[model samples]
Target: MRQRNFRVRSTVVAAVMVFSTVALAQPAAPLPATGNLQPETRAAQALPSLAPLVESVKSAVVNVEVVAKVSSSRGGMGDSPLDRFFGGGRGGSRENVRQGAGSGFIVDPKGLVLTNNHVVEDAVSISVKLDDGRSFPAEILGRDPLTDVAVIKLKGKVEGLPVVGLGDSDAVKVGDWVLAIGNPFGLASSVSLGILSAKARNIEAGPYDDFLQTDAAINPGNSGGPLFNMKGEVIGINTAIVGGGTGIGFSVPSNLVKALVPMLEKEGAVTRGYLGIQIQDLTADLGKALNLPVTEGAIINDVTSGSPSAKAGLKLDDVVVAIDGQKVGSANALTRVVALKRPGTVSTLTLYRNGNKQDLKVTLGTRPDIEGIGKRTPRETEESSKARVGVSLSDLDARTAQQAGFTRNEGGALITDVVPGSPAERADLAPGMLVVEANRKPIRSAEELAAAIKATPSGGTLLLRVLAPGANSRFLRALKVP
Candidate 1:
């Protein structure tokens, strides 16, 4: 049995040796010295091109021209019908017309175009020039400056228009190849390529400041242009470019644009939900001090009296962990989630108060129209005067005292309102806060508080003791009174 097994093993080894020699004796194929052109190499050498994508969607991009009237010392030959008929061509009274340009894309087949609000803002006449050199009078339907988005429509008959496809901005990620198509410097149909640099960027444009950052050569005339992904889908609207900075451009994510467009279309305006609460992020230090298990939540600093949050029993120092079970990790997150909710929607807010999780149902209220937003926003201008403390104080009447959760004997002025840009607002003196004392003196009325502020020594800090309605409410804050 041993001899038979050895014979079988030796035959197998001989066959392997014979095969190895034959393979070694075979001559190698003579090819270029570089390397083998394998299947994968050929496939990899094929670079992705944007030719087809650009060609497919280029026609949908339209050039927006806005003719606005400007003041001039001498009137030019150009005159409006109102100016010509009214004989208002005085040298100083004459107005000059200037044209501004931007870009947009056709969203609907019936000739609805979407662009940035600033493009056609305050224009006396608006026109959209298509790729085929067809110019049509355009009417501004609505605009939302908070997001810098606007929806315009083609007036008169419009048909057979090519529309650009909208992509999911949420699915877009950093390093994804994108193309920005716009009219840079009024040169129409210019295309630039770059990767998405970042997402959810806050440039302090407005309350809803989340934007998508890209390096796609966006410029002044590129505002309202389309930022297309490799799939030829519009994922962002190229909006602003950083001055003196290369490759830093911003775009409004299409998801947010899509959400706001419907409201802009229906009501020609955008309305947000207001919770009426001053909130801050639960930072690491705040979490530690509050004995929170996780540092991801929004902490309520002050709840507005007579507001939805105040009516819903939301209190100071309560950490909002989730909205409708969706986790909230920051103040911005909570603000966005609540703002996106429609008014009259009862949202289940899960809160963490003193290490105990509690659920509160909050009915959202309509956000008031802010001063410098929406289609009816006023033209840009410098603020002429700064507020003293940014707070509007009122004598504590019985109703006001009750609203502030204080008795008539509290001996303080009730803060009825807080100006957006004020020293008091900066010091976190919001509405419904009782100014118990100013300059270490008991504040009995608005006049007393004003006198205390007037007597503040130059460069001296105005010490104030503000009382809120809660367990951990009484606190002293200092504001620099110059």
Candidate 2:
């Protein structure tokens, strides 16, 4: 019986081995041709693959290696904006040489590579490694921290370098497929697929916060990589990702990069056109208060003395509706449009003042260096008055004015208290703030502010030019009277 069982098992094993060999030898069946099928059926049968697109553009992507010396007293090598998001560095007694890696794409045949500014910032030595295994030392051409864009030139480059074409970021729509090729976590030639999750994302990274958000698995080493659209055109440059969140990444739009690249390459820095004015978005309440027909545009809060806007006659409460025929939908839009023009270029601004539209041609000026404002403690006031708009105000005395960073002769009404749930509190009015003007008229005392509020018609709006304590600039606020 045992001999019979052993022979049966051996036979079964031989049969199974023979069947596996035959199955392995057979080739995969070809998919049926869809040429003669119905349109819907054909679409269903043909699956889309990014293999061809990847093959075409992958050569343009390169790896960037940086070596820099960082102080031990500071956060060390990982103290950069990019490193803060990804995390690195350690404290020590002496300065240390840190080596980091990032990614970039060639934008010119002469080895011009566009990347994020933080990638090669403060680098003592830089190297670029092509996807085709070629490597060369590189030098920083220029870098702009405001836009987080940088241009680097590859040294000792011969010829035939693959270059990626820039695409119109304005044309990109949400949900459009995007490809991100980079060296994530030092893994070279890594490709990720996702859609343009959002556009014009303001992550507060810089003054120009317009970023294209995507879910394309952007990692630490992916900084400064190119984000490609379906046409293999670069639409954005991957700059940042969420700290510990998945499927959330930010890229600087290519249009912004395109605007900055020429200046960066030629001058090694960006010189933006400046109109010296503090502005804010025209909200619905502000529009209604100003009796504006439309609730869009940038409302001038304060005009810098002797600045371009001041010289052009722009004043507080003026609403800029358009710039050279381009609509200014928000304050940020106005800023971006103005900054794009070269200094000394005359640009026409269409604005609304007193419910009338007017155009002003003003030559742009170069942006000046920003001065810091020092903070001071709020001084006590003896006199106080209550207003119908639900706020207690006091006279802005000379000592308090100087402490608040204003001239000792400056006259205004200081807010001593704001009623909870009242219009004052709702408009973000808080104690220690000074009301400099009411309805475009200067206020010298708490009684003057109360008089201005009393003069406003029932259910009307009270426009206040307010100077917050310890602030360097003034802002305009519209409060509705009950």
Candidate 3:
């Protein structure tokens, strides 16, 4: 139950997709030099219907069906995109088989289809159905779980397949007309219309989560589908939707897809260049604390010993402003740039160190395993007899904070455990969560938290400012004392 709080721009449940951590190469066609793409031209006559466009592009869309062995206790194909919509995020004990379905589109004429990793990952058998009612078995060419993108080849494809045009996602702006084509709720090839609601959204799905959000009616079966612009170009791959929420859906930008497909097809895995540094977006508080004149870069929190940064003389608290002359606005930007390049690439980094600007040449190394980051550890079960609010609280220690992925400066009481069906669970508090503030007051220990709870009025709603490890930001929650 690892979840990153992307509470409306802030909630995402972190799904651990087991895959190779290596990064592959980007496509040969580089991104456009600028965000200034030519505006789409359209006819002046009012179009009567979208029938012509749908007829032209619908054949490129596809429905994907998969069957795999799963735990009988869990009852179905593991955590699927549709699982969020259908309420099925559980696994079982006995070995059993399950079925799942989603959508995709042909990217190459020779049957190169693109879909989500979650759709066909761990699948024992896969079948794809074209819009023209032709079904064929599909073979996975490669899968990059990190990006939620997978490349599958449709077997027995008699040449001459229709391909959806890939569009520039950077050129896509809010309020643009968009159409989502997919199988929603098992509805095959269903089309929904909406406007681009947002862009470059970090749904906290992954570090490179530059998603295109739309108000389209994307539902359970819509995962791995295509999001198209009015010009009938595929701009996004529909991936996620807010459960039970109206008009909120997200797609992986097609530009990322275009960049990833070539590598996935070639290497069958992706490799990321690692700098061996933990970083965060420079905050005004950090800027003031560090005596900095500006707060516009990524601040190095820690540099791993014996890693590339250590060898490159990179230090803790170094603010990385640019890499290879490209501006790095935040931690994610730096991460995206570094991760996309191959290992052994020497990159020049402009850094602000102790209020002094400097440049360092760093040869990027392979990023090691990050899958264990923020994983839960066995807590010391030293407990008090009394329980207030049915929550077990412990003093935040360095070990607890590190295991929870919190920075060294973060101080708080740790929610060690939550009793089932209790107020803590109702308030969405869980183990490994740092309770930084209670009732708007900073709490340093369990004793302080108890005092704060005692200070609250009886049956009053207790306001909590909580920071979960690996989360982008702190969030507010309220619990009514019972």
Candidate 3 structure quality by residue, lDDT tens digits, 85-193: 2234355464333466778999898888988877766554568998888887776777776778888887763577889889999898899989989876567889999
- Best-to-worst lDDT order: 2, 3, 1
List, in order, the clash count of every candidate structure: 2, 0, 16
Per-residue C-alpha lDDT of model 1 across residues 1-482, encoded as one tens digit per residue: 00001111101011112333345768888765436687787676676667998999999999987654444455532123222211223367534444567789999988889998767654555679899888887767777766778888886668888899789999999999999998776678989999999999877666776789998887657778899999889999887666654668888899888888888777677878889999988998989999988888999999999999999999999999999999998888888878778998899999988889899999999988765443452212101111244456788777777767775547677777664434566688787777778877888887788777666653468899988854356789887653
TM-score of each: 0.64, 0.67, 0.65
Question: lDDT of each model, Cα atoms only?
Answer: 0.74, 0.77, 0.74
> Which prediction has more favorable lDDT, 2 or 3?
2
Query: Which residues of candidate 2, in runs, are more than 4 Å off?
Result: 1-45, 75-79, 82-89, 92-94, 371-482
Between candidates 1 and 2, the one scoring higher on lDDT is 2
Top candidate on lDDT is 2
Candidate 2 lDDT tens digits, 355-463:
9999999989987645221211111010122324557788877887776566554778888777544557777888888898998999988789987876775457899
Which pairs in model 1 have colliding backbones? 389-424, 390-422
> Where is model 1 more than 4 Å wrong at Cα?
1-45, 69-98, 372-482
